[model samples]
Target chain A: MTLPILQLRAVGKSYGTVRVLKGVDLDVKRGEIVSLIGPSGSGKTTLLRCINFLEAYDEGEVWIKGQLLGYHSKGRTPQDRDSEAVIAEVRRPVSMVFQQFNLWPHMTVLGNVAAPLVLAKKINKTEAHRLAGLALERVGLAAKVDAYPAQLSGGQQQRVGIARALAIEPEVMLLDEPTSALDPELVEEVLSVIRELAHEGMTMVMVTHEMSFAAKISDHVVFMEAGRIVEAGPPARLFGKSATPRIQQFLKPWLDRSLSI
Target chain B: MNVSPEHIELLWRYINAMLVTLGVSLLAAFIGMAIGFLLNVLRICYPRQLSIPYRLLVWLIRGTPYFSQLMIVYFGLPVIGLTLSATQATVASLALYSSVYFAEIFRSGWNSIAPGHLEAAQAFGINRWQSLRHIEMPQALIFALPLLGNQTVLVIKESAVASVITLPELTMTTGEIVSATYDYVGPYALLILCYWLLAQTIALAVRGCATLLTSPQRTL
Candidate 1:
């Protein structure tokens, strides 16, 4: 078995009295696509944010490429801090695609893709643009290299968002409902690109509402409710035979629709 | 009373001098703004560093009168043996004054961006500097343009105060011409006209730039 590229152990996050994530553990192996399916506000997005240290966790550890992230201890007290030093360390191998397609509106497509290569990776501008052009071409946005975010449709923008993620050559990519903001017709275009990335062996942990897509593409489907995963396994056994009533109830309508279609 | 032909010639000369003064002020403003922008970025990224000393400098320059600041640079520097030309003193004072206000304007503009934007950038492996250069600074500049325009116009007017140090700028030339003729009204009136025209031109340019900045698909 290939070693996992990412792991979250006993992860918990709370904002004041509300516990958003509670002792959740998850892992993503290299070249595997894992789908995180849950109700709204169920900590799916929070977990992704925590992996990249975008949201600091209250407890637990995240390991990326074998490095224990943000686990600092001088005295017995242990400090929970998201310093730039720690964030930069964790962010080196991970990239995220946001739900809103947060492309820098001021930058051209090439600029958006080339910036990280030049600034973070310390590559020259000429080589950065060259690589960025290649990444854009992979996502079929080569023609729109000079275009801005406002010029593109919802699907195209999401593809650009994906291209931006790919330009960095990340080991693990976290996508937080990447297609949620798209129109129904535009949804498949974004999903197909994601599907292509999965086929290319990109390790992805996706937060998705589309159960059918999750079932079809996911190597491991995790069913989350409230703030914890209740069922997780291969799509066939888990979706065909949900042991818990909660899992059954959640999957019933989704299964019926898939069967009808 | 007939406006003297020599006064008309002097008025034209005053215009030329004011143009030079404006150029100096523009350079100073640009330099000050560049430094102030660096400070603003540091303060935003690390709020703890924006200490009382930093705030005091901003407040001191912004609080004190611009003319007094010019006086300090012109006369006080001479007392310390770092004597600058009148034009240099004027540029230094106005630039320092405008930069403090520019820094505050930038700070406010940076605060206005949605946090989601930064999060998205972080997730994309575009580190801190990349995010600011490509994402944050451009957006903040767009929001700060109108205020920057107002500051630019103020810098131009403040160049008149340099005339006190005998800088041969518009106001100084007007004073010299009026004192010689004993008819201060004509030359000073034209000075006021010159300032009004300059301010209006800068204002129009600022509005035009702001329009293009906010327009869709133009930046790319």
Candidate 2:
């Protein structure tokens, strides 16, 4: 069997005394779309953050392409942790799109997209701009290259956020509630961009509230509740014939809303 | 308000002193901004170690009067064997005075940036220095522009305090002319006019900079 591109082994994270992620174990292959769905405070976002080492997991380990992230050991102490430069290098293959569409408001769209290339990848300015132009074109924001984030609508700004992530050419894209901050109309445009990326065989781990979209695109759906994974399997099995009562109860509101629509 | 040839000659003689006043203010502003930038960076990078000392220094500089600070630099320092020339003492005191205010302006500007901007920079795997240069510093400087302009104006006005140290700047030169010609109203009024014109020029230049820095096209 081929080794998974990303793996999480009993990952746990805590804030002081309160635990946010409780023993999360997961795996992702080369080209898979894994949708993490749960109610708020269920640690879905924390789990996604751990995968990219954005939030260091206190117990267990996260491995991307077989290299440990955040720590050299599972020991819960500052001495066991890797240096920041080492952490950055180990997680170089991953890029994240934040829920708030965290584009630098002071920069133009092209500058925002080109920033990661120039700053992280150490690419030359002229080539970075060329690649950034391509990424913007991919998101259909080619004309808004010189436009600032404040001038764009919510949907357009989120697209620029996605362009920024794509400019780095990451092997896995982690999106934390990409559409949660968008308006009803604007959500569709951002969703379509992700859907297109999914079709092109991009590996993604997403925390999303759109159950219908998740059921449609997800190869596997992992249901989380109160910082633990309650059920994990294909969307057809989980959404169509859920084994756990917790998952069934969780999906009922979403199912009812979809049927009515 | 009589038109006298003597007053005109005195004014002409003192033009170089006006230039010296302008030069001292400019030098102080430059040095103060540089020191303030360094202090802000140290505070941000090592808050635990530098915060108390940084805050205390700012308080000490700001609490005391500017003239007293100038006197200390010029007179008191000689007791400690650190004697400085008049111009040196004046510029040193002025720079120290201006840095504290500049540091506070920069701190407020840094606080105004959204936390997400820095997070985004980190998520992109940019190092600390790159993040500061490409994201944090540009935005912070833009936010600080108006207050920075105000500080520049204050610095120019405060250069007058250097007159006590016999720096031969505008105010001191005007006093010399007044004593020589024994014409109080004419020389004093001319001194006020020169200072006013100088202040107006600084204000105009600062406004131009603020507009350029805050403009969307120029910022990008």
Candidate 3:
């Protein structure tokens, strides 16, 4: 019961010769918000993906609620990768929201949220729809359940994305630049939905460029650069005078925009 | 076009031949899609074991001419003690010939699905079977429909190749009528007309299915 909801130790991944995540470590306790902030191509999104085993962590261990993910043991050989059933079981408590709002284009908003419940959880359709309704209500999308993803505006589609993640009742949700794909005017609606979840004590790890929102909502802020965590701590430390000069330089633009710091 | 007794007889003969051709084409199309779907699934889920060999099989089938393939089915297999009736050989050969291209269509269909979609499915811990059925297959079918319509027309036309084995389908019947009356133009015209009508019917039907399957969720 004391274990952190999600744990990663020295996790590393390489796409052939290109190393995408290099020896990153972090812990997210229950009811915590950790925001990964970095420049483009700095592996923030890859690190979040590794937590769900969406991108395999080839070099280290990820423990979800005390169970190791991806591999059956410490061995990193291809043979050591766990079976699909095993990987699915280990990652069952995790869910993800995508930058592209990867809602199935062929499904209505209700169908999108209820899909994992039906397909992954094997719950009956009626019950799945009922739970999906609650999740949609949470994101204020209850009225749009019958609508298709493309029928909705960008912010509305991403809310459906959040509702899909929430419908699974995930122990932790990974958001890969949740608002990045939205038009500038539409970002706030999706962020408000996320802010509601944070207030309700949702455990989440988000990769975001929303400097002020991340500063406002995050309990722990991590600065990453070139595939490694460069600096991380409480928001005040990371956003204020104690930040590394490199991290400061990275935040300088947002700082000029006058972050809450 | 004056209505004559000989013309009525020719029209009747053409109708019977059209039925036979439809039977063969329909049977071949279904079998080809089933085999192609299975072969595609094998390569995707078991790439290390089956990918190279299946790719070679698909390539070999695609490269060979249909006429020679039909000859092999009709003549070559009998030499190895696998004899089949002429009609059986026609359907079997056409099915085998088209399955590889169907496999290619399926591969392209799956490839057209965004990587992000699969990643989201995986992140939810959707089982492999469920993911295939619910996530990948439906979307893939959307991409495959137009290609499938194309393959359907190709199979109908290619059934003409079965005339060499004397299966008595439309093309074979045309040859017989041509020889009997020395009337090349009328029987040939009937042959083209029958195939053109059949192919268009199927294409229209496939388009109907596409609309039915996609309309409710069709992004506005």
Candidate 4:
């Protein structure tokens, strides 16, 4: 049996006493596009963050290519947490594209994309720049390489964020509302890039509110609510005939809107 | 306007004192900026170890007046057998005083950086030091430029306070020239001109640096 590229076995997280993720079990096989659809505050973003150990889940295991991350055991104490170096090593195969397009304003497009490779992977400047150039080209941003992020439009800046994530050559890509921050006119450009990545068989777990886009591109659709997975299935099954009442109710507005459109 | 030749010659003789003033200011600014940079990094990255001590140092230095701090370093420390020369005491006190402000400048700069930038770095597997070097420091320094320029001028002006310790800096030399020549007006006027020119030069240099750091067309 082929192992999943990313796995979350009963993952759970909380802030103070408010539990955010309650036993989230998920697996993304290679060449899969899993779309996480949910209402606001449904822990979709938190789940994506936990996959790369960016948020540090307090319960269960996150396995990237079969290696556990962030903690050695289920223990949540400070002592039980792994060293930063170890955590980085385990999560190196995963990259994330954020909602805010957190491009460093001081850096040019090439510098922003090349920085991760140079700093994290120990790649030399020339080689990192070459890779960054290719990534930018893939995102249709080759001309903007010399431009500062502030000089670009919001759509263009988000493309730079995607290029930065792509330069690392990740095994799995996690996207947390990648197009939510863009203007309505600018959203299609970013969505097209994501759709292209999906067609190329990039393993992606994306949290999105764009129901139509998610339904069209996702191999698997997982609906979440109140920090739990209410339903999970193929796009056809989840969108055409969801078994759970909560997911049906949650997706009602989106489904109706898409139908009306 | 019967300006005496002796008075002109004495004023010219104070050039060495002006050099001494500039030298001490340069040294103090360099050392103080270095300390402030290290302290800010320590507080941000290793807060568990250095946060309390960092807060205490900022409070102690910023709470006291610069002159009093200078006196404490120059005179009070002698009680504990830590005696410094007049120049040494002046530089130390000035460095400590400026470091407090520099530290706050760096802290504010670092805080101004968007949280998303650091999050993106962490997601890419960049280590903490690498994140600071590649992402945080450049942007923070850029954000802090205007304030840093103001602090540089402040340091240069405060160097004049070294006159209290009998150090032959610019202000002390001007005082000496006036006392000997009995021409207070000429010597004081010349001193003001010299200081104004020095401040303007520093201001011009800082503007150049700010342009270099922040010019968007410069690229990476």
Instruction: Report fnat, model 4.
Output: 0.77
Model 3: per-residue lDDT, tens digit, A37-142? 9999999988988888778888988999999998876788789999988998988888899999999887889999999898888899889999999999999989
Give DockQ per model, in order. Answer: 0.35, 0.51, 0.43, 0.60
Q: What is candidate 3's CAPRI-style docking category based on DockQ?
A: acceptable
Candidate number with the higher DockQ (2 or 3) = 2
Candidate 3 local lDDT, B1-220, one digit each (tens)? 7999988888898999999999999899999999999999999999999989998998899998999999998999989999999989998999999999999999999999998888788878777787788888989998899999899889999998888888889999999999999989877887888998998899899989998877755321
Chain B TM-scores, listed for every candidate in order, come to: 0.86, 0.88, 0.94, 0.89
Q: Which runs of model 1 end up more than 4 angstroms from their true locations?
A: A72-91, A236-243, A248-261, B1-8, B67-89, B112-114, B124-146, B161-168, B172-189, B200-220
Classify candidate 2 by CAPRI docking class. medium
Model with the higher TM-score, candidate 1 or 2: 2
lDDT of each residue in B1-220, candidate 2, tens digit only:
8979976776676688889998999899889988998999999999999999999999999999999999998999999999999989988999999999999999999999898888888888988898888799989988887788789878988998888878899889988877877988977888888878887887798788867765656422
Candidate 1 lDDT, B108-187, residue by residue in tens: 88887778888776765556776787778888998888888888787788787777778877778888877888987877
Let me know the TM-score candidate 2 reaches against the reference structure: 0.91
True contacts kept of each: 0.54, 0.58, 0.65, 0.77
Q: Which whole-number lDDT from 0 to 100 does residue A28 have in model 1?
A: 85
Model 3, which residues run further than 4 Å from truth?
A1-3, A16-19, A258-261, B179-184, B215-220
Clashing pairs in 3: none
Q: Which residue runs does candidate 2 get wrong by more than 4 Å?
A: B1-7, B10-17, B168-200, B210-220
Q: Estimate, for each residue in B12-57, the C-alpha lDDT of model 4 and write its tens digit.
A: 6667777888788878887888889889988988889989999999
Residues forming the 10-long window of minimal summed lDDT in candidate 3 chain B: B211-220
TM-score, ranked from best to worst: 3, 4, 2, 1
Candidate 1 vs 4: which has more TM-score = 4
Clashes of each: 1, 0, 0, 0
